[model samples]
Target chain A: MIKQLILIGLLGILFGVFFVSMQDIQELYNTFGKDYIAATGFADTGSRNLVTAILLDYRLFDSLFEAGILLIAVSGVIWISKHESQEKNAQFMLDKFKTPDLFVTFSRLVYPLMLAFGFYVIINGHVSPGGGFQGGAIIATAILILYYIDADKDTNIALIVTIEKILYIAILLVASLSLVSRGELFTNFFVIDASPDTKAIYLVLLNVMIGMKVALGLWTIFTAFLKEGR
Target chain B: MNPLLTFVVILIGFYGLSTSSNIIKSVFCVTIIESGVILLFLNLGNLDGGVIPIIGDALPVGGIADPLPQALMITTIVIGSTVTALALMLCIKVFHHYGTVEWAEILSRESGK
Candidate 1:
């Protein structure tokens, strides 16, 4: 323990040294970059949110690989934890059983609002702070509420996994559409000289696909944990 | 100063990882480390008088926060959660195998076998 403590102290010293020598961070490496994004990001991606524009357009290929990583991770998790005892056919349904008065009332009031907000965030991602990942997480939280309302609520993990895989493929295909129109991937053809409405649709479509994919992926992981050793 | 604090958070995680005997505690330590790293990245990217990354009619891009770090951090957050889930799942399997969550106990048992 003493030796480990010393190692931690050394780590802290290293971090301190790095921070002390850190350069001024306000001026980015490219002085022109932030201004460029702010000026043209909307025209380029039709998304009011510059971060989303950067994510789904500027560094889109990276985003694709990022989603792929999640896909692989989810698959690995399910494979590692799978058991023969699991039902061959599982389904996802809301809680049919009743809980305490308070829990049920809470679910009834909050669940719809949560679900609607998830959609709102996703659809308005181009225009707001929320986007695919955040909105999808919110939707996943809403789904989790069902378990609290009724412990016996039937959830279909396999179905969710399948849906996630399909969505990923769709995302890849949709992203590749730009490859045909332009010589690059993930850059929308409609972006070059398209109307604002078309650009908005493109961003919304991508957001919805990503939102669904993430929500399903997260739900699968949650279900896997719940079914562990069961 | 805030950067130093974030670094301290990382050190705290390191301290926990080095001292914690249990497997689950180690997983939590890694999570703490991830959080600290995320915080540090955001701190570095935080501008003095910058607004949020969202562009509006009134809020222009001239004084907006750096979008690069925020975007990268979103990816980092999702990756971290998946990693934590996988780690916990592994911990569960390890416990099932050795009948204990303690690192030393598991190590000792392995050698005994």
Candidate 2:
């Protein structure tokens, strides 16, 4: 009872602090801050989507480290869940799941479509609502569906890790290419000066690299969990 | 999307964090807090009659919703998920060692309290 009172008291204090600090959300947003991005972001990054422009171009360095964080997390999860030699042939929890026949059939039907949609999102990131991270997550979800269809199905984990690392390097190389092209780093050079064609290509290529890295990283993390104690 | 509502969601998460005995429940509470934060940001960045950040000829005359918060929160969401995954992995290790996921149970077993 004392613990519960303390918890409630702490929460009340925190809530009061947050409430007092918060401004009227309706009054806060004005033309000065967001207008600039919405108005000129397209001209600057040559991407129809302002959010994507901000993510991949203006804040490219942060996005790179974002992928790095994911890589580190995947590695940490795998390390912590590493199987002992004695458990090499142990039964997996994933194998014991009794998936219904309806799920299996539906998964098979939607598998190809989900994969295609993921690619579409990545490819059109500069033009539309979806981008590398979201698209990659969708692709990972698609791969996750595969587990439901065939619990015993396995992937070459090592190969996926290698591919993810390579994609990360490729993303770095692409982001830095601006340094050689126009003596700048992180910003897409084509977005700045090159014709529209090259701009789209640079943005799409980067999106694809980031997408693949994220997809494979997430899959690796899932695989590590499924393979735990085995 | 009221800021107060957003804060309430966070407060609920904190309440759960404080009271929940299960390690997995605590992890879920942390996730709730993250979601609350995300909602708060998106809410604060909202405009009254704003359109989507995507630009076109038919763009509304009022304004576009703030894209900065949305972009930044995407980073936050990814980081939050990674944090949750790492925490859950730790929880699994703890479960394996102590054969229980309750915080009080683990501590009592560990310190012989």
Candidate 3:
């Protein structure tokens, strides 16, 4: 009871402080007209969605490094769980257990739809709220569902690693190309045309690449854990 | 945008972090705190009367929510989820080595060893 009271008191104090500090602040949207970026973003980056414009065009470097951070963390997990001798063989474990009929039926029905939605999100990222990271995480969920249905199925870790590496290098190359063409990294280079549609295409392509890379990276980490567990 | 609610949510997470003896629970509390932070950031972008931050000819003209904070929050959310997953993996490894997830038990065992 005392602990609960202390917790409540702490939360109340924090809430009060936040409430007082926020009282005078104005919402930016009211003061800024349309949006800070909405005025120029469509013409500048060819993305209808201002958020996507900021993410893929204006602040691409941050996301590039975000992907890098995921890569490094996955690498760390793989390294930490490298001792395979003690771990029970994942394939053997898989062979021993029978998949439930209901789960199998459900997964089979939902898998294709989930995969399609993830890809759709990636493709339409520039035009909508979904983007590479969101789409990638969704795609990873599809893989995770599959893993849940069948623990024994060998996830092609080698293939995923190869694809992830290719995508990383490709992203870097695109950034370098942007540096060469625009004299600055991650600039919206395709905005030279009268219509910004061409630039939107570039953003979409980047989204797809990032999505696929993230999907594969997450799958790798997940499968690594599964294998280590058994 | 009532920031007080966000603060309360964050404080709850912090309270869980401080009180939890289980390593896994602490990791989840970290995720909870991250979610609260994300909510607070997205709230900052909202207006009383605003349209979605999409530009098109046919759409109604009005104030649009700030896109920058929402975009940054999306990135932060992804990073936070991945970090949480990594933390869980660490907890699993710790449990494997120490044979217990409770901090008290792990510490006692370590000192005894």
Q: Highest TM-score: which candidate?
A: 2
Give each model a TM-score.
0.91, 0.92, 0.90
CA lDDT for candidate 1: 0.81
Model 3, residue A23: what's the lDDT? 77
Compute the interface RMSD for candidate 1. Answer: 1.5
lDDT of 3 by residue, A1-230 (tens): 79878887887887777787787676422545345476677877888888888888888888888888878777776777677574456653444667788888899899889999999999999888798999999999998888767766876676777788888999878766776667777666553554787787688888988898888888888887778666
Per-residue lDDT of candidate 3, residues B59-83 (tens digit): 4477677788788888787777667
| lDDT tens per residue, model 1, A26-129 | 44444356677877787788888998898888888888889889888899899888886756333233323445788788898899899999999999989988
Q: Per-residue lDDT for A86 in model 3?
A: 49
Tens digits of per-residue lDDT, candidate 2, A81-159, equal: 7766635542366566678888789999999999999999999998899899989989999998887787777677879
Query: Roughly what TM-score does model 3 have, to 2 decimal places?
Result: 0.90
TM-score of chain A of 2: 0.90
- Using TM-score as the yardstick, the better of models 2 and 3 is 2
Please give the C-alpha DockQ score of model 2: 0.71
Candidate 2 shows a clash count of: 0
Please give the C-alpha DockQ score of model 3.
0.64
The true-structure Cα RMSD of candidate 2 reads 2.3
For candidate 2, write residues B11-50 as lDDT tens digits. Answer: 9998998789899999999999999989988887773658
Cα misplacement distance, residue B36 of candidate 2 (Å): 0.5
Candidate 3 global lDDT: 0.79
TM-score of chain B of each: 0.90, 0.89, 0.88
Ranking by lDDT: 2, 1, 3
Off by over 4 Å in 1: A23-30, A87-99, B57-62
Show pairs that collide, candidate 2. none
